[model samples]
Target: MDFRIKWLVSVLLIFGGILFCTAQERSKPLVKHVVLIGSDGFGAYAFKKAKAPNLRKMMENGAYTLEARSVLPSSSAVNWASMIMGSGPELHGYTEWGSKTPELPSKVIGDGNIYPTIFSLIHQQLPNTKKGASYSWGGIGYLFEKNMVDIDFNGKTDEETMQKAIEFILTEKPSLTFIHFDQPDGAGHNIGHDTPEYYKEVEKIDALVGKILSALEENNLMENTVILFSSDHGGVGKGHGGKTLLEVEIPWIIYGKNINSKGKLESSVVTYDTAVTIAHLLGLKIPDFWRGKPILEAIKYEEK
Candidate 1:
């Protein structure tokens, strides 16, 4: 009888230890890498008719919203700046669509005399973390502090840009990677939003997204990686920078490890929220000056 009791106690202790270890692992941050993909002029409305199976799969498996809003004026540079800087143009001060520098002085300038951005925050907190940015737009290069980035590549086309981003991810295994595609915006400007040609451009971008996903999977980075997809702004007619719903509303999608498979997000998401979300995933300190809040509902682990 004493032998049986001892055996039972041993089994209980082993089981208890396993449970404790599992809980501890769950409480720790699960995301080790983050890939942020931004598509210029890819509006939320495009999903209404655009047959983007790959993006649709991400939306179904991850937390997403078609109602995420852009900052006022709904332009490229201002909204892109807001997305990474965690504040509006009032704080980050890139008010114009073609703004190469802050039209108004930034509310808080960090190490490089540039407004505090996600890249800056990550660099300050995780000094050894590899960071990379690949974009087809030349204007995007000027928004953040280049000195903090390890690899900054500007490709002549969206295809080339994403290809370079894949190469960087495979070779460098960067902790954070931001990719910007300039198509669909160029198509929207040259053609017209809501037109058939614009939809085609969005479809092409979707194919590019598929390629990126494949690369991540091939390199076995998907297990520890989280991907967030968003846009600078939507468009209406042949141009943007307006107050129309078609121009202000954008799509936001988050997928991968530690993300709740909440089909669609109900919470209100803004451009600045992207930065805060990335910071939260990487376990970095979100600056008090930033106006954005992390999308906690999409995360599986309870942040303490």
Candidate 2:
């Protein structure tokens, strides 16, 4: 064979291999499913003190930030609302306790129809995507659009809520699934926020997290699912509704599907960022009304 022809063939083969690899990477969707787990009244200090092997392992395999800020008054309703809607109380307008808009029907909890939640946005943009949520505190249901979630369950306890969510994920393979646990918040109000009892509840939640992950793994869906774990707000003593550091500081953990392992995000990651990041991963558009930005660096992509 001619030397020039041989060299040309070698170069063509290398270029073809590169093209194939690039095509494969693009063919694999960055995120096909998202699991957002919200633990009420879970603070960074309590997370540090608790013996949560599962959580630690998740953190080791994902990008985390202990400084994820929660919107004030630091109450679960307000912050959870903010987290899901990707907006603050000023926009979503669910600041106080109880039902925000009692006049509005169930599955619709925002101030008006203007500020739709992440679920609503996802469903509206991609109607084919399946979404669901299970909450221990029923009030949290108000943050999301009802029709958007295929399976919505407000359970009696955290265990029941998590079990139902895991079952839903395994069986239905929802594009988005949210699970809210309210035990730490209950322990915070009943006993103390930073007490040993609160830590025990945190440990239990960690175990629950492990179970949820295991279910995803068992179903072979972990590769395409992005798992994000965070808390609504932290409590100071027996309650929140304050502006203290302990009450506002929260731990945010992101794992699975190209997320950086053992990565630490050095930025002001608020609770609302959850919606933004999820939207970005699933190739959905982040609405202009959203106040959060995607944590672009934490994801697996070579910075240009």
For lDDT, the strongest prediction is 1
Which sections of candidate 1 miss by over 4 Å? 1-28, 302-304
Q: In model 1, what is the error at residue 200, expressed in angstroms?
A: 0.5
lDDT of 1 by residue, 1-304 (tens): 9999999999999999998556323123458899999999999999999999989989999999999999987999999999999999999999999999999999999997899999998798878879979999999999988999998999999999999999999888888999999979999999899999999999999999999999999889999999999999999899999999899999999999889998898899999999988988887777878899889888888467
| TM-score for each predicted model, relative to the true structure | 0.90, 0.85
**In model 1, what are the clashing residue pairs, if there are any?**
none
Model 2 misplaced stretches (Cα beyond 4 Å): 1-29, 102-114, 302-304
Worst 10 residues of 1 by lDDT: 20-29
Each candidate structure's count of clashing pairs: 0, 0
| 1-304: candidate 2 lDDT, tens digit per residue | 6999999999999999997556323122368899999998898778668998888888888889888889877887778877878878777777765545523232334333535777876786667878889999988876667766799899999999999998898888888999999878889999998798899999999999999989888889998898999998888879887888798899999999889885688867988888888877877766666788788778896455
